[model samples]
Target: MSELILGIESSCDETGVALVRTREAPGQVPELLAHALHSQIEMHQAYGGVVPELASRDHIRRVLPLTDAVLREAGVALDAVDVVAYTRGPGLAGALLVGAGVASAMAAALDRPTLGVHHLEGHLLSPFLSADPPQFPFVALLVSGGHTQLMRVDGVGRYALLGETIDDAAGEAFDKSAKLLGLGYPGGPALSRLAGEGDARAFKLPRPLLHSGDLDFSFAGLKTAVLTQAQRLGQALPERRADLAASTQAAIVEVLVKKTLAALAATGLQRVVVAGGVGANRLLREQLDAACAQRGVRVHYPELHLCTDNGAMIAMAAAMRLQGGLEQPRRDYAFDVKPRWSLEEISASIP
Candidate 1:
């Protein structure tokens, strides 16, 4: 019962392609064979944010080539693929269409089945791509540039929403604050790198919803505080930018960590899975590890590279869903993408 799955992802600025092999045993974890990713970071850097049209065009150019490279790297033939997988929703419509179109076309030409994957579900299951994967019945903290959410994962396709951001996500807060401090495009990582050089206690910053008696998050006030601080510093801003960045990161991380712990407590789950791009934050990992360890709770993260969106996660998610009987690949090639889909909707869609 081995099946080769080819996965495509173009939900945003990255065009990714990967191959994964499902094992004979239904419970065995799917294995990643080869994967390729092309990030639009450098191209988008000029704009200080992603430009959807350019992103879609780049995806159109990159997806096929990346798919070729992946197949070569894995030493697999296109005809050997049993299924073609692609990111379906919760992303840029045009970008999503590029991947969906390519994937469905390939599957149709090869006479193979196709699976449409949710972008966040790929993020949620990404940790399985790591050397160490968590068991079921765990709490998941999914923080990315556009989303921040906590959920109780009972098993494949079984998820319960615990809490989520009410305003800006953690990654948004990081990037927006970085922009406010004059850091250019892809501000989150830039702010994080600069934060390492400054003292976290240098400035007092707001930690939104830290004591709201609920698991919801709100980072708008924190971003506003950062804006106010930058304005107050005025000409001296450059001299103290690192401190501001550090303090801002601290504020965001503190809220994420505390809320995750609260979610674990509420769900009574002993393990927590951290996924998505923001999970790559060194400080967030350190703080969460420290806090969770004291309570004898295990924390798991995707391999550093896998924390960002990639085809491996997409392939892995599709494979897992199929293995769990949660999804069945369809033959119809006509496909659509969801540009504004939410996790709540994903939960509702799960059978």
Candidate 2:
């Protein structure tokens, strides 16, 4: 029988819970049974951004209910779970603790072991559970809410950071630029939607470090350019906002696509997997698809719904790690959550 793994994720504004079944074969990708998520976007809408304490409180309110919902949807009992996993780090301290504490407590109650999963790793490996999963040894472009990185992924647990944003992340640039245009909270998607109606070339925006002779990215300058342009428009800003939005999306996408291709060229890898929330951008997918197709590179992405933080990715990651012998679920139950652990902190070579 496959091992039933229950995963929890409360790294940010969403509380996610999922069930995954790890096949007995060590190399097989786990199968997702069911998943549930509660987003705090509406709760934070009034603030124009997430408040950490509020997010933590919401997670506390939602995690268990979501877990119960997942288990019910999966038709699995708590006693059936063999391992429990939760996002351990690289997020708000309070949120991380909420998930870790809940997972550990649940695991203890069931006499099951707990595995602490890394948040970025969940995003990176998420494509494996996609309809069309990419093989190992691919270049990965990870663009999430707070991070934008290019990495060489040899296999599960083997990740080499190729390049990353020096200042603001790609998502941050989207949100900040949207805020400049008076787009409401959770700005990225709103800005992207507005951009579709305008001409991308109407405004000339800076593509910072596009040709910096390396893969490192810089979006801070681009944000500054957007701000300066918005200020210059004065009273006419609203009329030209869509064009500016289009231009802004274009600049970020150009830098991201170019950098990703550069990483692929440098790695000499033909497969590329893009994950995280920004991967859902229609423009990005279209442009990257065209570019990668021209280069004979196979591109993959998590399902649009899975692009955001979710328990399925966390569960899949934990199952994969277990399959790879990368980490072990522990019965000790005494756990500490890390708010700033790096993806590179894990050892790639198995002991």
Write down the worst ten-residue block by lDDT for model 2.
342-351
Q: After superposition, how far is residue 35 of candidate 1 from its true place, in Å?
A: 0.6
Q: Best lDDT goes to which candidate? A: 2
Q: Model 1 segments beyond 4 Å from truth? A: 349-351
For all predicted structures, in order, the TM-scores are: 0.98, 0.98
Flag clash pairs in model 1: none
- Per-residue CA lDDT of model 2 for 218-303, tens digit only, reads 99999999999999999999899899999999999999999999998899999999999999999999999999999999999999
lDDT of 2: 0.93
